[model samples]
Target: MGFESVPSLPLEGLETVDAARRPVPASPGTTTTPGAADRAALRTDSARANGAATASPAPPDLKVVPLPVRRAEPGRDTPAAGRSSIIVLLQQVQEQHGYLPRPEVVRCAGEAGISVAQAYGVASFYNFFKLTPPGQHTIRICQGTACHVQGAQGLLERVQSELGIQPGETTPDGLFSLETVACLGACSMSPAVVIDGEVFGRVTSRQVPRILARYRRRK
Candidate 1:
């Protein structure tokens, strides 16, 4: 649940360009071409025959709408309060946009009357606050002393080579993000790497390609 020797930097407020950008619109266009309309009608009939759609209209499933998140307001509040404030703000941003974008973080901070530092402090403290978008799968390698003593470095190199990315970075195809954590507390199984939080302990460099292949198969 905790780690030591992890190299962490303070979170910074979102950039200006992001803050100024407009939210992306959802929903498909209703306007259709003559050809598209014919194709859609045929597909609809096929789907209905396949039981994908029922003859009688079915009620839409209930959707749980999340509450709007608000950022912390910088006051004489304690750091703990500030952290909660930041979390709230981030939640609001995510709720509105469906993801936490850096610019939104800054905009939310400004809207909440909090300082960028306050937002960054909270963002960096929590591992969940991703500065960049995550991949379909995430791979975390242990850099703890015990793991390092074993073959963690070699394992990391294997991952980098296979994924073509260094730690704290994601693949160009957006299939994986490689992160280095100080320790996973699996000292007994040194040189561990976790894919999607599932630990693979005593991992050797030779296993890197195989491990990656397994993940690729999943994708």
Candidate 2:
């Protein structure tokens, strides 16, 4: 006998599962999808890793080094300090040679580390520093105010004529060297003439020949 089939169950009362909505098992080296905060954190971490791998090594510690200082040697002076010594050296050379000879002056300038012109300038400026050799006797005629008022010009002319030389020249016989001085400190005896260190004051034009004859007769 055929029996009537029971009615099919209602699909509305049963639950259904979708394959796409189900949780999946993760494979090796696979991760789940990250949220916004997690994605930001992962990017920061990746950037830091890359920067660390490509960065240069740190430099060594810096040190300050001082340079060496130089000290001057003993008894050695600078060029500026040595200028004053030049005068002293020149005086000594003049004392040794009696006059500043050209060769001696050059030698002195070399010793003093100065120029030849400088030494010559010093030599020529001072009246005491004679350039030419002096004769056996030196005659200094005074031309001070007292002597000038007392007819010293006449006495000078007489001396010049008798010696056959100027005021700054030596005689051909090498006996007398003539020079003119500003003062002889003998104002009381004006018109003074000094011959070989002897002061002859109140000298007239006639007395010049007699005074020079005394020195000429001397050995």
Candidate 3:
């Protein structure tokens, strides 16, 4: 039987048709090259995937700086410089009060920015600073080396007996206060006694009553 023959397709055309029908599998080591738009889309997807990791802001810089150290300078305004001023204030208080009164000393300490104990220490350390009030008249007996050798003890005893008071004591009448000093600067006249700023040289124990009588008469 004689039949009509159809045209046979080319091998390349068949390969093209097969490729359109089903995708060709890539070789093991081969990679597909991407176009510009495809590459850009891929980059956008990658950025979106890693957005959480790269979206945070950078941390701030922290630097530690040390403060400057201050040193005290010597001047009239400083604490050490105020020492002389405090002493002067104490002296003024003594001059007005005749002695270092406890209240006045406390006030002075406040003004000087010092402790009460410190103020009292200064008051007690010096021989001139008297803590008690003075009597109407003050009597000082010298007990220096020269005076002691010249029977100053006997004279002091006589005065105490006559006044009915011991050294650093005030008479019952408050007319006189007795005090013994290391020296009266009258060494040339040993056994010197000073009553109300009057210095009597080489005094004897017998002369005690007469010397005391003069002050009594004045009172």
Kindly report which residue stretches of model 3 are placed more than 4 angstroms away from their true locations once superposed: 1-86
Q: Is candidate 1 or candidate 2 better by lDDT?
A: 1
| Local accuracy of candidate 3 as per-residue lDDT tens digits, 62-85 | 443443423222331345433434
As for lDDT, the candidate ahead, 2 or 3, is 3
Clashing pairs in 2: none
The lDDT of model 2 is 0.71
Best by TM-score: 2
Worst 10 residues of 3 by lDDT: 9-18
* Alpha-carbon lDDT of model 1: 0.72
Clashing pairs in 1: 11-120, 69-92, 70-89, 71-89
How well is each residue in 12-35 modelled by candidate 1, as lDDT tens digits? 332224311334446587443567
Model 2, span 1-219: residue lDDT tens: 112233442222122444334566678876654664365566667767888554332232344344342222224534433344455666887788777789988876666566778668767766667788888999998888899999998999999999999977788888888899888889899999888778898999988878888988893
Worst 10 residues of 1 by lDDT: 11-20
